[model samples]
Target: MVFVFGVNFPEQRLASLERFYGVGPQLSERLMARFHIHPTAKIGALGGRQITDLNAELTKLTIENDLRRKIQDNIKRLRDMGSYRGRRHAMGLPVRGQKTRTQITTARRLNRVDRKG
Candidate 1:
């Protein structure tokens, strides 16, 4: 296993690095390039130094629990301020101007004051 912060990634798995909450393909590619790691490399192929370096870089970014907390805090702040977006979140509706007449399942599930991701 290869551990990034508190998360354990299987060594046999590809080192996509998108498992972190706030990380995406672009950021993952940037990180891999910064570490001189190839895109198709496996977690097991990483050297100890590379792993440490990657950890160091990851720590510098707002990811995982920190990012989640930040988003939740922003929602809470909006709610406290009674903003339109806050009201939408509280109502479990779309906050990005999506139509609410139908097909709002995703927004209803995700747009809430206590969001997990």
Candidate 2:
């Protein structure tokens, strides 16, 4: 196993870095390129120095809980300001003008004043 940013990632392909919150395909590819790790490289195949470098790089990013908290803060700010989007989020409705006539379950589940990470 390899520990990256306080999370344990078992010996898996480098592409699995996308499993980290806020690290999408593009971000993961960039991270791999920076480390010179092959796309198919497994966690166990990484050298000691490479692992340390990865840990340092990940620490500089606002991923996982940090990113979630940042988003929640932004929503809270809007709510405090009484913005229209904040009202929608507070009411558990679509915030981006999506039709609420059908398929609004996603909005109700996600757009909330106190959203869970």
Candidate 3:
């Protein structure tokens, strides 16, 4: 199955970018620390970078402005791995984790959370 999400928001895009690289929690935390963005920063809490240039996208709205290019590039890089990592990417599993059997999942759970609660 394909994971389809709207990345119209910069905060959402930043989050999606972290996952796009398949970077783990440690790396994500480190990157956030280095970049000076709060670990719990919401979109409104961010400035400058959180603004997506709709005008830019409207003008140069090719892959350069599209998330599809980034996703394709990562997938290509993984495919070039030719083994282990590539296989994990293909299977949608964490390429660096040991708890593969239990942790390898997509957004299925998020879509079907316990609404009764």
CA RMSD, predictions in order: 1.1, 1.3, 11.5
**TM-score per candidate:** 0.94, 0.93, 0.34
Candidate 1 C-alpha lDDT tens digits along 56-102: 99999999999999999999999999999999999999998999999
Q: Candidate 2 has what TM-score?
A: 0.93
Worst 10 residues of 3 by lDDT: 108-117
lDDT of 2 at 44: 83
Best by TM-score: 1
Q: List the residue pairs that clash in candidate 3.
A: none
Candidate 1 lDDT for residue 4: 74
Q: Estimate, for each residue in 1-117, the C-alpha lDDT of model 3 and write its tens digit.
A: 112123344444333224432445775576556556666665444555433332232234233324445555566576677766555665555666557456445422221212110
- Model 1 poorest 10 in a row by lDDT: 1-10
Q: How many clashing residue pairs, candidate 3?
A: 0
Per-candidate total of colliding backbone pairs: 0, 0, 0
For model 2, state the Cα shift of residue 115 in Å.
2.2
| lDDT of residue 108 for candidate 3 | 23
Q: Which runs of model 1 end up more than 4 angstroms from their true locations? A: none
Query: Candidate 2: worst 10 consecutive residues by lDDT?
Result: 11-20
